[model samples]
Target: MSEFFQQPPRAGNRFHTDPSLRLLTQWHLPDAIYEQAEPQLERMGALADEVMGALAEQAETNEPEHTPYDAWGRRIDRVRIDDSWRELMRIGQREGLVAIPHERAYGAHSRVVQAGLVHLYDPASAVADCPLVMTDGAVTLLQEHDPGLAEHYNPRLTAREGAWTAGQWMTEKEGGSDVSGTSTVASQDADGRWRLYGTKWFTSAVTADMALALARAETSAGEDQGLSLFLLELRNADDTWNGLEIRRLKDKLGTRALPTAEIDLVGAAAVPVGSLGGGVRKLAGLLNVARFWAAIGGPAGVGQLLALARDYAGKREAFGSLLRDNPIHRRWLARISADYEAMLALNFETAAQLGQSENGGPKELARLLAPLNKLACARQAAQTGSELLESFGGAGYVEDTGIPRLFRNLHVHCIWEGTTSVLAHDVVRALGAPENAEAFADDICRRLKNLTTAGTARVKQKIESELDVLMPLVNDPREEEARRIGWGMARIYQGVLLAEFAEWKKSAFDDDAGFATAELFCRRGLVDEPFPETDADTAGRMAFGS
Candidate 1:
């Protein structure tokens, strides 16, 4: 009986196996840009199967440790991470994970290519992408504000060699998403150096060499306008502590392999990135970039979860039959797959727009879509992860199976960068811009114009109606109204993207998977239909129809 045990599930190169990802990228990028990125994508595909697959398991099991002092009681404040974690970082740097878009080697399509690579790498990298997000944002922020800072740090941040990552330290005890409540005070010293003097409550990736932080500068001004953005170097030129004290490392729910800590700044030497009064405005760039990365992480995680669950279903047997043969299980898997496919379309579409915006195209719609994408994808990833875990039955509950980690890692996506409630409010605020609202509505209309299917037309009408109901309330929305309207808007937008992409899939590849996914998304996600149980044949067709 023991010898007859089922063989462990094996995953091939994630990039090569994911047809949806390939098709989406092909549809999104220009031929010239795709040609430039093809080699890198192929390399990443192979690495994802070999290096990342093993490292992910090692990273979760080993986790990270915070050693505040050495054996002699010196204030070392060293974070001891698994060797696998370090190797992952090295791989990220070597692969130009952070450099590609910034380098712009592929012209206007750089961000599109970079986003595609991130979608492939993030899930297998064991959340190492968290710090990469900050690093990339910091590089962009510095480039826009202080060229000298960019010249000094951008090379190292994006280095494929001796790269050093950056962190974003905005959360304090008084404020999570509300940067206006930040109390960390920045004071100019006799040498004209700005020094931060307060505690940062939640600083992830404490191992970073430098961080972009928000601090209120001392001034006669009575308002939060005194808040400023500062660049704090964690270590000095002599490689010594720079008046930063690590209070303790956080015991987090997930991403445990990435060190997160609370720290007190006592005269921590810093440099101002932008004008003191423009901190919030300047930090917007970083927030947008971070939110975009957070958005991509959702579908990437969902892809991994679905792959694991589907593979497990094929192998695991119950009552003289494989789990994949169970009709009810297939239905559940199909629904999750449909949601995943819709999210991929929505995410990559946003990615394409972001690339265009960077290359001097329109920015208004991307601004509105970033937060919406983040909120929708994060929530869906968490829900799908939970469902995938359940499909594995008792084995999923055990740590050894690695399925539990998917759920644990996904939960953080909802809370990190910004909570769901915070993001919903952000969507309302973005909609307050009349031009942004107009652009969002116009884009949806344009995409829907190409889809002639009756079901799709109905989805489009429903979305427009929902937007009609929500648009008027954007100016002065109550919290409950904002949440309701924001979620509705996100669903409608996702449905539109799916419907458009499904049409493309049918026309270009003669694939019905996209249509099936779009149908499932609209019926269940937009119209609130109950889950349906299907026979094995119907279940297989619906779930894996693509």
Candidate 2:
């Protein structure tokens, strides 16, 4: 008898392996634009397999180390990460992951190309994508609000040779999401320079070159009108700490490779990005982009695991046949894949809308889609990630197989820019505004106006029904029903987007399962098929403390 040894799952180049991403890119980009972008996309895809996969494996074995002192025990406050992390950062810079959209050589399709790059990078960058996300947001905010700072910083932010990673410093000990209650204050020094004087409770990009922070700056009108956004350089020209002291690194649940720190900002030099008392309003630009990252992250992470599962199914034999040949396993994978397909479609739609806004297109539609895309996509990714990971059976739970990392890394997206509940409220508020509500209605009509496929008609009908259910909550804009409203809106849009993809697949590629997949996704995903009344009642009675 021959000894049995399991064959490890293999993943090839991301751009070539992912037909869904390829098709979407082809659909969004013209032939001329695609010709320009395809080589870069393919290069990043190869990096995903050759470089990032190894880095991810290395990070699992070795975490970032914080040494508060040198050998002589002086306060150096040094955080040392593996060389692999640095390599990942270089790839992000070299490949123009953050710079592509900002560069805009491809016109409106630039963001679509950038999104593909980001989705490919996120799964294996060992959470290096965290700093890049903040960097992109900082670049966007600085370019829009502060010209001098933008001129000084953006060149570094977008540079390929010496790119800068910017930390987002918003959460403090006093408040997590509610920045209005912030205690950190920014005051002018004797030199007429603004300085931040407070402790940041949590800062994820502790190893960043610079940081974007929110600081309390009061005016005579009210003593505390609101917060203002500030940009902080972590180091001086001599490379010493510039009025900043790292207290300690966070002992976190996951993302061990990403250095998160608690630090004291005592007289840290800062410059306001906008008006002194306008950060609460001005912060929308940064938050909007960050939420888009969170939304993309959900699907990107799931796609990573799904890619592995795709390989494993063809090789792993069970009940005298490969798992791919087994009806039950194959059907289960198809369902999870369908949901992943739905999320990619929706997030890419968000990307396209954001691109339009960037290139002097409709601003209101982008604003409305921001919160809706983040909440809905994050929630769906969480569910789909769990299901896909479980498809590997025992190997899914094994850390050595690199499968369990999906869940550990996935929880952050659900809470990163905003928690699920927080984003739901944002969606409701966006809809509450009259102009935003009007733009949203027009967006729905615009997205669904051209339907060429029969499946799209069914998808359209299903979406109309969901709109009937969810549109009322948006019109009334209640807090309690915000979750349903936000999620329902996302589901409807995803259904329509997937239907459109199905039509393209059939007409362009002569595929039939594309239609079935979209139909099944809508049927299963659009509404919460209510559980049995007795089962729910009993479950509720026995739940938790009860």
Candidate 3:
């Protein structure tokens, strides 16, 4: 059996053969894009695996006694592995991850979603709220403390510049995802310094070195209008919490590894991010960047979950046969495989588009696609993982099996940047905008018409057939109808796009063995499934002529 599986040749192992890792490393960069970034990506992956592996091993033994904030710490610690947290800052500095650094100073954010999954699972507990609020607070503080540190990407800085390992930014409280509702106050001191005073909830505030907090600058001739981002260094010169307080932690279902803290910001020393009144817009840039990373991290947990379930099926025997041999199990594998591939393709494209911001590219388009990618991929990851678990029968429910952990972790991604409903509204809003609605619609049409692969073409035709039924309703511009149309079009367009890429990959370009695994994404994402409701709607509409 050992000889058969052969341990999927590890990156540096004697005979490691992990197809997925190889796929990620190889196909992540297209030929045109791979030439420059390939080496960096590979190095990053290797470093990530090394740090992550060490942490995983430590987690097994160091399982600290369950504390309320363990989830938050664990998640942050997971991201800090090797140099991921630092690397992210470096990437942001180089070109502003999604136009936050170069264009907006406060957009220097981290991948809390990835860390959140692991942290939420930590023994310590808390109730769930927006993690982005916590991230905002952390990012602001770091940039303020070291103005030049935001752009530090070189490995040498890891040793030279001492900074907080990981922390969260807390901006949203009752304001929902709307940052304008923020009421935290920052008053200038008599000694010519600034201090923060307010109550903030859903703060992923940890025992880190700094925090990025948003508050209204204090003045006597008060206007509730002035909002600013402040970087408050939480740790003292001796590394102690001086004024910031973590009031209580929330208890939650998924992402227990990261604690959701209710923080009391009383006389917390702070500095502003950009201009005082410009904080909200600055945070928007940060949120946009956060949204992009959330999209990327969404699939990470899901992929891990699928791999776990696959391992379970391969090992567990039932009804006088191995689970892997069952046709039902095979079908489940195929289905989840398709979901993962679709998500990867969508996110990769989104990231690539975001990277183009440096060349004066269309950022609004990236912004439009960002929410869709975040919401769609995160939702899909959770749903897909749950479905995959059902295939494992009773075994998956057991904690020792580890399927539950992955399922819970993936669940957090859906609610992170924006909720599903929030995302749906955003997509509709984008569609209604005069600037891109027609172009977006036209883009959908072209994708549908092109029909890149046999597998995708069929799916595209099926979605179109459904859209035709909803056409009359869509033309009216009602929010509900528009949302339905938006979702359907995005999915269909994605299918077409994936199929086209699949066809391209199958052409003469790729020959490397590493691409072989990643190629699975191209083929699997293009597979067509039936959509009878769409077809039925179109038929009914055509017959009624109303």
Return the TM-score for each candidate structure: 0.92, 0.94, 0.70
Cα error of candidate 2 at position 490, Å? 0.4
Clashing pairs for model 1 are 513-546
Please list all clashing residue pairs in model 2, or write none if there are none.
Answer: none
TM-score of model 2 vs. true structure: 0.94
Instruction: Sort the predicted structures by lDDT, highest score first.
Output: 2, 1, 3
Q: Please tell me which predicted candidate would have the highest lDDT against the true structure.
A: 2
- The lDDT for every candidate, in the order shown, is 0.81, 0.83, 0.52
Whole-structure CA lDDT of model 2? 0.83
- Candidate 1 wrongly placed segments (more than 4 Å): 219-225, 453-478, 525-546
List model 2 lDDT by residue over 169-235, tens digit each.
9898888887766788888766668888898988998889999888887442336545788888899
Candidate 1 TM-score over all chains jointly: 0.92
Better of 2 and 3 by TM-score: 2
| Residue 475 in candidate 2, Cα distance off native in Å | 1.9
lDDT of 3 by residue, 1-546 (tens): 355431221222101222333333234444543444334344434433444434433332232122323454531121121232233333322322212322322121112112222221111111111233234323433344435545442122222134233344554566866666877888877775778888787755354455667788975344443887777666678754546666566565654444456777778887776566677556555565566656655566555555556666767777888778989778668667766766766666665555454245665556567777777787777788788778667766876555566577666667776787777777776656655555555666776677554445545555566556544443444564544654554454455445655555555455332132233433443222323456656868887975
**Candidate 1 local lDDT, residue 238:** 87
Tell how far residue 478 is off in model 2, in angstroms.
1.1
